[model samples]
Target: MAVSQHASVRKTVKEDLGAIVEMIQELADFEGMSDGPKLTIQDLLRDGGFDDGVLSNSVPLFHSFVLELTEQIRTGNKGKITSCSSNDEPLTRTTIIGYAICFYSYSTWQGKSFFLEDIYIKPNYRKRGYGELLFKTVAQHALENGCKRLDFHVLAWNPAKYFYNRMGAENLTESEQWEFTVCQGKKWMHLPKTIPSGSKPLKS
Candidate 1:
């Protein structure tokens, strides 16, 4: 099926956290990691600058974008359309179908870069160009913010890698042997003391 012409992408607001987290779980389930997602709506609110406690002028730790389509496009989809207007004049209800999460990072060799933590479209919504629309939207956001590079990781077996390749993304793991690593929980907490005391700082 073709993507709805009324589909649109925009920066996420505080209200979008619930839908975003739900889709995050859906993506995890699709990847065969149903228990992988550990984020909560409170976390998104704080990290995305939607929490009132967060300083208004401070840059958020992350940014998100969501893709929405009007109710007319989701007519027969069970449990997809949540609310509708009382009037009969073409229900203007919208539903969040996809989302992208991103954060900025610095590269000593390349300056500013943007990292796409996740991007996902509903299973029923895939193959209709919505994923590409969301991906391009994130890329444009990166460019507008002066990012020189956009980076993300895809599982070696994921078919989405082909889509990314078509969009001109490079596989650094294959081309440059760049491996992704992570440290969390106790390991991350102890990382500060792991450095040798006598280690000398390298000159910049």
Candidate 2:
């Protein structure tokens, strides 16, 4: 399929959650880890504060942006447009082809930073600059929010790492030997209730 010339990026709404979740699965499958994603649309709606198709008054855990293409492209036997009309034209349809989800984080050394949880473009839409557009959108959002850095993890075997390298991203694992670690499953869910020895829990 040819790349759509009317592609644009914008903040994600609640209605986009379904598509986002679908794409998230697509990304996980592409990474050879199809079993990793366990989140649902409700999770995203609550965490991202997109319950009303807009940012909620309460603080949000994350934010997202979607790349949409609005064009007069029709397919199928009856030549029926399957997507919503953008300009009131029956043939014009808007489709979400890519998305990026991110959250703010604090670094002791760098103060504020942004962490990209996921960025995905549909398989058919690859190599058409949509990925770059989504990535740059996330970076720009981070800078606008007073973030000093942007961080994300990419699989070592994935070729997308080269894209990040081209966009001036640093591989801390290679340059600083910083290892990413996580404590989850049973142990994480069942932490000790009492402080060990003389160590007291800090007041919230």
Candidate 3:
């Protein structure tokens, strides 16, 4: 599907916070995300909308429309955005259809740069050109930033892999070169100490 182009993509501000949060919940329900409600409206407002907060780190200023799906259109109801922003920009609604979120990262193996994240469209709003718009928006941003690649992982169950492949994304049969490691809380205390690094076992 060729991406349908859009004329403007602007930054969102504090005023748009309510709508953003609504969308977050909508995405949680759509994705069947178990921890959706775990994130409350106050969490978003305090961490993101306020100065020096979680929103500042996790979401971009005005372009954090990460989840895609225009459920409101198909359901004949209004959708929401479940986050906050620095600017109160008007939420541009165009049968939102879907959303995509991406950020910059370096590929130590390839010695280049790329994007890693998800693009989700509401189940009911699929194939309405909203997905295309989101993809195009991200792709253009990737190119503009001089990134050599734009990539994402799609689950086998999604069946969107076919569409991604058709859009020129290469699939690997054996991705043995890549390995993931994350440390949090107790796990973070187990590793060797180097420059403020340590992983210690928890006390009973």
Candidate 4:
């Protein structure tokens, strides 16, 4: 599956936010973690730090890249893929099949690094090299920005482990003594105060 011939990757625009949010929900559903997505369009816009055309770390928490089909791919009764007219403008009516969201961080020991927070492709569109293309796109940005490493997490049960390993990703658990940990689950929604101070959790 030659990825170049299928889809084009680009930075998402304001108009693409709704569809991107939908894809995020689809990913969550596939993982069987939750039903709807925890993030919202407004939240994305706020934390994404889209200021006067620059991604200032002080404002936005993450950056994203969207993969859109070049040809029309039916998503719903009315959803269809469209093209960007001027190359710089966002495509209208285009079906976004996948996306890669990342956030930059300092690794202390390794210097600069970027975490691939979320990468997902519509199930129907998987196995066509789209996933690899998305991964490479994010990696390209990481390198261009002087990042020493790119990190992300995958469920131990996920078959995608084979793909990651094939691409030279290391398994810290087996290769070293580092551990991966996260804070969520039972105590998440029941928190006494908002985690980000003024932000609201996604609607249940």
Best by lDDT: 2
Inter-residue clash pairs, candidate 2: none
RMSD of 3: 10.3
1-204: candidate 4 lDDT, tens digit per residue: 111235878987777778888888888877888764778887776677654335444756888999998642233323333343333333334568999899999898999999998898898889989889888889999999999999888888888888788778998877786778757887775675646766766769
lDDT of 3 by residue, 64-153 (tens): 454322222121123244331334333333444344545667776654455646566656756766666667777777787777788676
Candidate 1 deviant stretches above 4 angstroms = 1-5, 54-57, 73-88, 193-204
lDDT of 2 by residue, 1-204 (tens): 222358899999889999999999999999999998999999899888877646454888999999998875544444445563444334556889999999999999999999999999898889988899889989998999899999999989999999999899999999999888998888877775545867876779
TM-score of 3: 0.56
**For model 3, where is the 10-residue window of minimal lDDT?**
68-77
Candidate 3 deviant stretches above 4 angstroms:
1-14, 25-32, 36-63, 66-97, 109-112, 173-181, 189-204
Model 4 clash pairs? Answer: none
All candidates in order of TM-score, best leading: 2, 1, 4, 3
The local lDDT score (0 to 100) that residue 94 gets in candidate 4 is 50
Worst 10 residues of 1 by lDDT: 82-91
Instruction: Count backbone overlaps in model 2.
Output: 0
lDDT of 4: 0.78
lDDT accuracy of residue 20 in candidate 4: 82
Top candidate, metric TM-score: 2
What is the TM-score of each predicted model, taking all chains together? 0.82, 0.84, 0.56, 0.73
